[model samples]
Structures are given as structure tokens and as C-alpha cells.
Target: MKAKTIFIVIVTVLLTIFLMDNKDAVDFNFIFVDDVPVSKLAVIGICILIGFVLGFLVGRPRKTYSSYNDEIEDNYPTEQPKSTLSDEDRDYIS
Candidate 1:
């Protein structure tokens, strides 16, 4: 999954660079402004940074076995059995 994500990011970056280069080919003056237009690399870098931040913010912490055991215990009762079976009923006949 990580490899696939990396591959997608690489492809997207290349596509963005291609589009930006073509778009700017006839409008070279737009690249000189600080806010008129941004470079594709900068845009991609920002996107990656935002993705990392969002992922970190939304990711859940790993649960330990003890916590899971405690949760299960809390949900289930530990009292005695509700029914009693006779010794003759212990064996099943064919």
C-alpha cells in the first residue's frame, strides 16, 4: 500500500509539473509575482505537508492487549452459571 501511494504521488507530481510548464510557457511574467502563481513543486510540497498533518491529527493510537482484555471483561459478566446440568446429560448418544 505504501509503494502504491508513493507511485501515485510521483505520477501526480510529474503531471502537475507538466501542466504548470505548459501553462506558463506563454505567460512567463506570471511566475515572477509572489502571489500571482505558484510553482508546481511548491504546490505539491504543500499538499504533502498538509496530508501529513491531517493524517497525524486523525490517526488513532494503537491499542494494547491489556486494554482489549479489560474492555472484554467489562462487557462480559464473571458470575456463576445460570443453569445446572445432570451427570446423565453430560454424555451424548449417537
Candidate 2:
């Protein structure tokens, strides 16, 4: 798991640097509102709204079966095993 995390971090950093260095080569021109005269404030507002929605969705905690079961089990006390008795205690008396 540690190695996977490190690998992901290294890959993410390398990709970020590579993309930043070659950003000019990438064609990401938008034509919807670029050609027309539009309010810069409106574009900023739309971007903020989109970001808020995305953050809310990603930040929400995901539920799992184990989490539900853990909550239910917490309410009950678990049983423990009994101690072993002496060998004489195992002998049956007539």
C-alpha cells in the first residue's frame, strides 16, 4: 500500500510537470462563449458553481456494509471463552 501511494504521487507529479511544460501544444480552446462578448464575472461565477458541486460530491463519505455492521455490533458486548478446568473435574463419578 505504501509503495502504491508513493508510485501514485510520483506519477501525478511527473504528469503535472509534463503537462505544464507542454501546455502550449494542447488545444483546449472553447468556442461556446469565447467568440461572443460575455461578462468575465459570469464565467467566473459558473466555474465556481461547477467546482462547488464537484467538491460536494467528492467530499461526501461513502457507506459500506462493514461500517453498518460495526455500528450494530458496538451496542452488544462480545462473549469470552471460559477457562479450562482441572483434569479431575472431567472424571465422571459413579
Q: lDDT scores for all predictions? A: 0.66, 0.64
Give the runs in model 2 whose Cα sits over 4 Å from its true position: 1-29, 32-34, 68-94
lDDT (Cα, tens digit) per residue for candidate 2, span 1-94: 6999999799767755754454332223375644454454455446656987999999999976677678767976577557486667767432
* TM-score of every candidate: 0.38, 0.39
State the lDDT of candidate 1 residue by residue for 1-94, as single tens digits.
6999999899888866765664331212445554445455556566777987999878968757678779888988878666566666665431
Model 1, position 16: C-alpha lDDT score: 66
Model 1: pairs clashing at backbone N, Cα or C within 3 Å: none
Model 2 scores a C-alpha lDDT of 0.64
Winning candidate number (lDDT):
1
Give the Å error, residue 60, model 2.
1.1
